[model samples]
Target: MKLTLIAAASTAFMFSLSAYSQDMPGMKMDGMEGMKMEQETKQAPVADAEGTIKAMDTSKHTVTISHGAVPAVQWPPMTMAFSVTEDQLAGLKVGDHVSFSFRVKDGKAAIVSIKK
Candidate 1:
């Protein structure tokens, strides 16, 4: 009985491997290699956020903001540092309330526009 079970398992494994090894005809249309269409990216839409500036680093051109809940990305209220241009940092200070728009990609967020 044990030998039969092992044979059955090995047979199943070989069948699965063969199924995957078989190439689909549609995968290579007209034999065009390396000319595949650009895969669509799931870029998140820009989200408006409200937060208070908790800290800033001119050298890094970034600000630490404690923001409210963000529904656009389903993120809970949290404090995170966001990258911004030096020009955008002008006229901004710590402890000031502000509104901003930002986009997140690859687990990183950048402030697109900000104003107090």
Candidate 2:
């Protein structure tokens, strides 16, 4: 009967879909992947910091700062690159002292603001 044929076809389709999902890259069978992705996207709060500009790359829009200890984030003095805006780069040069605010996400840092 048509009803019997239809039921068999539906079962086969479900099996094929399950197999396809398992074979795909980054496809999740469980729902925990969503939770992991959410955690990765969440970033720490912005912290106040101060340091000297060790290097600057106007073309890359990045600056390397040899910053002092950041008590708010418990970070020790170190030189690291930070993404910056064109306005932030204006008149700025290496070895210049700067007081700035920054946030770290996915192990990269960026300058949020710079104080004159």
Candidate 3:
């Protein structure tokens, strides 16, 4: 469909401009089928990376990071938001570079551990 292609293209553009990892397609949860579903649901393996904090919202309990490509999830270098715990967001600020461990489930990334 036209919308799917457009969405895919838009995501690709955004990822191309992102700072973290590079080159792993398929971010939408609604359209996934087969291996795509497997990729989105696979969460046992943790991916590690170092990146700059782009934004954070304590109320939302999420942090946006600009990081390099994460092979574990096939994510391209780009900025993306991750759900975090209050402890994970503590003391971290925009522009702070930190290392973190995370896993992806249903196209959502959740931080397991983080430190500056």
User: Which candidate leads the pack in lDDT?
Assistant: 1
| Residue pairs with clashing backbones, model 1 | none
Better of 1 and 2 by lDDT: 1
lDDT tens digits by residue: candidate 2, 25-97 = 7756796645656667777789888889988888898999988999888889999899999898887888889
What value does the lDDT take at residue 108 in candidate 1? 86
Ranking by lDDT: 1, 3, 2
What is the lDDT of every predicted structure here?
0.91, 0.86, 0.87
Worst 10 residues of 3 by lDDT: 29-38
Q: For candidate 3, give the lDDT.
A: 0.87
For 5-114, candidate 3 gives per-residue lDDT tens digits of 99999998888789457555766656445445555665477899989999999999999999999887777899989999998888888999999999876678899999
Residue-level lDDT of model 1, residues 10-115, one tens digit each, is 9999999999999887674666665656554455689999999999999998899999999998989999999899988899999999999999977889899999
**Candidate 3 lDDT for residue 49:** 90
Model 1 off-target regions past 4 Å? Answer: 1-43
Ten-residue region with minimum lDDT total, candidate 2? 31-40
